[model samples]
Target: MLKFLKQVTDYTKGAVDAARFIGQGLSVTFDHMQRRPVTVQYPYEKLIPSERYRGRIHFEFDKCISCEVCVRVCPINLPVVDWEFNKEAKKKKLKHYSIDFGVCIFCGNCVEYCPTNCLSMTEEYELAAYDRHELNYDNVALGRLPYKVTQDPMVTPLRELAYLPKGVMNPHDLPEGARRAGKLPEEILDEMKETQDGESEAASANAK
Candidate 1:
């Protein structure tokens, strides 16, 4: 009889505890209701997004070496890099650079793989449209290169060196013979080297 009584008491205690928890939750809800709401008025009030917020993708066609690194790096392969050699012009003209914004995962792989740092993320997120297909773009319309002939110093020369099977062959780091014969700005060179060094260190640490 005593055992039965004890069991009943324990069950009652458990029920009371659960009820108390529910009451506490409801109290919190009521407290929140009393405070001023933090939501912004959409389309009227502007809110600044955080630094790492991924929005629209921008590509600089001029700095693009036609390497197709962006196409390879994208998780969903949203960007299509295509080119055809113009027989009369004696140069390969970019036939198409299509980005299917509908499928982009915003992983930022394309920004990292760009040899010329031409691809970057922009902070414009209000891209509402009637049709999803409207999101696709021809990259050339963004802008033309050589607005100013600011030289890049870091690209290494195209030397007949032994195979480096893995990773990018930072042209600025290569021998002079393998690189384009032109005067590069010293500041750009230093910046590239510093970035490379930091990346290498970080990679090493990650491997360990």
Candidate 2:
């Protein structure tokens, strides 16, 4: 009789615990139901992108030296460079620099390898087209500057390397000390500041 009574008591305790858990879950559900919805309406409303968001690629013709570094680094061979040597001028002139968005993976390799910092990924992600052929962009189209240039802190290292116009630096180029410290050197920081200032001045001039 004692064993049977103990079992009944244990069963009752288990039932009570289950009911308590169910009640707590229901309470949480009801509380959430009272809160405002967080859903965003597409086309009408849009969420702000994160700092490091990479979208469409943009090219600055003035800054590009027709180095063909972007074309060489593209994994999918999407970037096309058409240039010819000007024998009299002793320089290479860019005839056409194009990119096909249909095959572009947006891997950012082209932008990273660009020694002149002429190539960049803009935040214009709305790239829908009825004709696939329309997605291919030539130098005349891609060379247009964006209305607003996003400054991503994640690309601080890239901006710092802008000081060395003829040199290109990658993440692997960082010194062991700087890499371990997770901090940029004073010289790099100064160079970044100068680059920012120069870009701002250029933008202002363009606005005029």
Number of the top-ranking candidate, with TM-score as the measure: 2
Please state the error at residue 150 of candidate 2 in Å.
11
Lowest lDDT 10-residue stretch of candidate 2: 156-165
Clashes of each: 10, 0
Candidate 1 wrongly placed segments (more than 4 Å)? 1-29, 33-36, 86-91, 140-208
Clash count (model 2, backbone only): 0
Error of 1 at 130 (Å): 1.3
- Candidates' C-alpha lDDT: 0.64, 0.72
Report the lDDT tens digits of candidate 1 across residue range 28-146. Answer: 99998876445544443334343455767777776676777787777776688788877998877776677777778778898888888987776556656799887776675333232
Give candidate 2 regions above 4 Å deviation: 1-38, 147-208
Whole-model lDDT for model 2 versus the true structure? 0.72
**What would the TM-score be for candidate 2 when compared with the true structure?**
0.55
Can you list the residue pairs that collide in candidate 2? none
Expressed as tens digits, the lDDT of each residue in 40-149 for candidate 2 is 44544444443466888998777777888887788876888888999999988888888988889899999999998989998667678999888898887787655332
